[model samples]
Target: MTAKPPTPVRRFGSIVGTVLTYVAIWLGLVLLIAGVGIRWFWGRITVRDMMISLQNVDLPAGYTREWQGFYGIVVAPLVIVLILAACHAGHALRVRTRRLGAWDQRPRRQRRRTRALSLGLALILVVTGASVFSSSVGLADFVRASRSTMDIGDYYAAPEVTGSENQRNIVNIYLESGEQTLSDTNLFEKDPYAPLEEQTSDWQSIEDYQQYQGGGWTMAGLVSSQCGIPLKGTIAPWYGGGNTAPPDSIRTYLQGTTCLGDVFKQQGYKNVFMGGARAEFASKDTFLQDHGYDEVKDLDLWKNSGESEKDFRPDWGLSDQRLLDHAKDEIDRLHAESEKTGQPFNLSMLTLDTHEPATAYDYCPVDTESRLISVYQCSMEQVAGYVDYMKDKGYLDDTAVVIQGDHLKHMTSSDSFHEQLDRNDHRSIVNRVWVPGQENKRRLRPGIDQLSMYPTLLEAAGLDIRDHSAGLGVSAFTDAIPGGSAQALGPRGYRELVATDSKDFYTRAWDGEEVHG
Candidate 1:
């Protein structure tokens, strides 16, 4: 007897169910791939951070190279879909052949083959679903921790610089993705930072400072250095779903936070921030403006100044050479204004040539195969030249210059560069203070965290902050003295402390529990 065909309603239901199953499977595969890929590419970032940062950040124009790691991910879904379709087609073909009495007496091997294929398909679907669910739970937990953390309100209290007598001008240079390890010849065949080491021998170096336990990105490093507090994703998006845009602006992210910029402003110092990248990107402008900076400038300013895109690279705004040139002009302008108004100035700039995944900028020297190494060499040259220019113009007469890397090298593909360095050695960010008068001063301690730079900058400007600490930080210089808390937390201890405290601290911080409190 021949079987009757299903009704129209039943047929429609079957098609809809099949379509929904395919869609669900595809969605699960994507979630699994994204979660795993993010962890692999950016190991230092938390899932919450990846969510929050991407909300306001766009991949740079030349970031295609960075996505090379994910080529497998792109092909994975198609492969899965094809396998599923092939299995279904094979089963349908076998059934149709049997119904036509052509395969009614199927061999035992064929029956076993069909059974194994069914099991394998079921296993794949089960594993994919489980992986997606697991990663989704992890992401949810991270968000919960972020939102339930203590409030950060009043964590960064304003320092009392009311009775300040000597206030020198400040010049801060933030080198992107720089590290002191570049100076170690063991890390590279040729010493990339030899020139920087030779020229800045008189500068104080803090080899012990830890970075990225609290925050890992550029803005995080900047906020940590200035406010002595790590930049964490405490604010959640207003949308109900994951990775949605936050209802509030980034400026309000740290509404009640105070930093060195605010302190400098209170002391009648003119604050200026300049960088080679866009000021608006990553909400850096908002952070700077919130901290009371004036005259914020970046690539937008450079472009508006009549410099065409002919000189600009799409990877990351302008080259370090152009940034330093513009910075010199800004410094000269600030100097003249300071002289006129009798107000000290704080001119801060972030260099971009060294940002990764490494690109070949104009400043990079010929014959260097590694763009990472070439950028470091270019950075040293630009910095040394800029220092000489400042000295020639007498800008250093009463100015304290702070030079530090925004964060440690972030490119995972730069494993070739790090292959020569000792495997056990802790990768460190660069922090050097060049106080005009105390040029010979150096910190002998093991290392310091980024937080210490806050008080160190204030100290370089001749502020006595010993009585009142710079938030959770101790001056790397002052802490070098015997018996200081920061001095006691040797490199190993500091690393352990950050690792132990970061999760709990960040959780409470997001919940509005002030660190100081």
Candidate 2:
């Protein structure tokens, strides 16, 4: 007896089920690949950091490899789905052509077992994908940390600027991925910071300069050192709401908080910022403009300059060599104006050659076996040369220079120094300070982090801050810290405070409210 064909409704339901199954398979594969890829690229980044990076998605040209890898991962799932569809199509065609006799007439028990196994495989994929994805994005960690109710506002201290007797010109340089760990000859083959250290041998150095939580990136580092607070994003994952999304919607950056630039502006200093990367890359320009920078020069300015296109790096903008050369000219012009007008100026700049996926410039010789190390050496050499130029021009007599790392090197899988850095437990941010007419050098107070740099920088520039405190930090220039300040809380306690969720406190900060105890 011949069996009758299925009803139209039954055929339609069958088609829908097949389509849903393929969708599920593709989604599962995509989730798994993306989760694994994120881990491979950025190694267990915090959810706050991830959110900030996502909201400000202006990536530099140097991240070509990362972009290409992401595209491949996304397409992999589609390729897999297509192959599965082709296999199903071939099986259906064989059945329709009647090429196999008992293919569709297999035992009911065998068919049921096959269906059960396939369902089991699908379940495994979905579960594994969800697990990996959640872990990679720090979802579990965020949830755990949300339970704590530590408020930064409790320890916050508003900067009390009592005015300086003699305002000195300030030159602050933020080194990309600068860490003293790179100078540990015990870990690596040689010290990449040797040139920089030799140049600033007479400058005061800060020891045990810990990198606090939330200050592990460039923007975060900038905020922490200048504003004396961790850079928190608007997302309140604990509440499952975006109540404080000002960073995305508003042009003002931390309008409620007082930063180095703001203080310098009040002091009648002409604040200027220059960098090799685009100022708009991470809304850096917005932050500087809002905070009180008079002039901001970046990749756009360099592109418009009459320099050869070959002078620029394809990934980031200009090479450190070119950036420092331009910086010399800027300082000369600024200094001349300051001398004539008797007005002190602030010049801040960030270097780019030491950024990840670093490349060697033609002007710099390859002294080390690793290209990354050579790049580091070359970049440091250029910065050191710039310092020498400042010294030659007699700017050091009336200037305060602060040279520090923006943050520790990100130990992603693509980074070259992870093998050495991962093993060392005593890693710290590299920093050097130069104050005008200082006869003796004093060690910075122990157990202080980037927060202390806020007051420290102000003091270096001849400003007198009350209690040597600003925001949550106490100036490293003094041994005494206020009783309730964040520095007095110690590094361990400070980390715990910053790790927890402080939505209300941060909301006030973003809203430009004066938050203080």
Candidate No. with top TM-score: 2
lDDT of 1 by residue, 360-446 (tens): 656566456666787678777888788889889988788888888988775443334534432425678876678876543654344
Q: List lDDT for all candidates, in order.
A: 0.65, 0.79
- Residue lDDT tens for model 2, 47-136: 766665555454346655456555656778889989999999898888877844433455545645765676567668877887887888
User: For all the candidates, what are their Cα RMSDs to the real structure?
Assistant: 7.3, 6.4
Candidate 1 wrong stretches, greater than 4 Å: 1-158, 236-253, 361-363, 412-424, 438-446, 466-468, 480-517
Q: Tell me the lDDT of model 1 at 433.
A: 72
Angstrom error of the Cα, residue 302, model 2: value is: 1.0
Clash count per candidate: 13, 1
Q: Model 2 clash tally?
A: 1
